[model samples]
Target: MPEPTARVEPDEIRRWLSERAAYYLERPVEELDPGAPLAELGLDSVYALTLCGDVEDRYGLVLEPSAAWDHPTLDALTAHLLAALERG
Candidate 1:
């Protein structure tokens, strides 16, 4: 794990996740719907796993591979990450 940094806000995480998901979907970050399900936004299992890795690397926190499935949407996932960071 990486060293903890300053506290992070949900919007920042949301934007980062949106940008990442958009990259995997080959879409613009503006095209992403924060309320939409990741799968519905065209993120498959491979993309999910890739995203999980990205989250770990970016946030420096260990996470279950199923974190995406558990959160399901950008909004939910952002909230989950915020909570996790708080607990961190």
Candidate 2:
């Protein structure tokens, strides 16, 4: 098996989320918050999947299909991602 990469910090996760949110929502990164729900921020299922793909590409992490529902907020998602990274 390939060695796992180091886990990203919360701030870095937040930054990554903000950038991805901006890209998917076509809005300014300054407006995104880690506590905001993706649905509340205009993310539908398709957009969420696309965002997941972007995250996987950026971080080399594969997200579960249910991640969008399970980790609804950016903060929750970041926490889950960090945990997954640690486990890997």
Top-TM-score candidate index: 1
lDDT of 1 by residue, 1-88 (tens): 3357678878889999999999999999999999999999999999999999998889877778898999999999999988988888
Candidate 2's clash total is 0
The 10 consecutive residues of candidate 1 with the worst lDDT sum are 1-10
Cα displacement (angstroms), candidate 1, residue 12, comes to 0.4
lDDT per model, in order? 0.90, 0.79
Give residue 72's error in model 2 in angstroms: 0.6
Looking at model 2, the pairs that clash are none
- Evaluate model 1: give its TM-score: 0.93
Q: Cα deviation of 64 in candidate 2 (Å)?
A: 2.1
Model 2, residue 54: what's the lDDT?
73
TM-score of each: 0.93, 0.85
Q: Which lDDT tens digits does candidate 2 get at residues 5-85?
A: 654687787778778878888999888776889899887898788878877887778887678779998889888877877
TM-score for predicted model 2 compared with the true structure: 0.85
Question: Per-candidate RMSD vs. true structure?
Answer: 1.7, 2.6
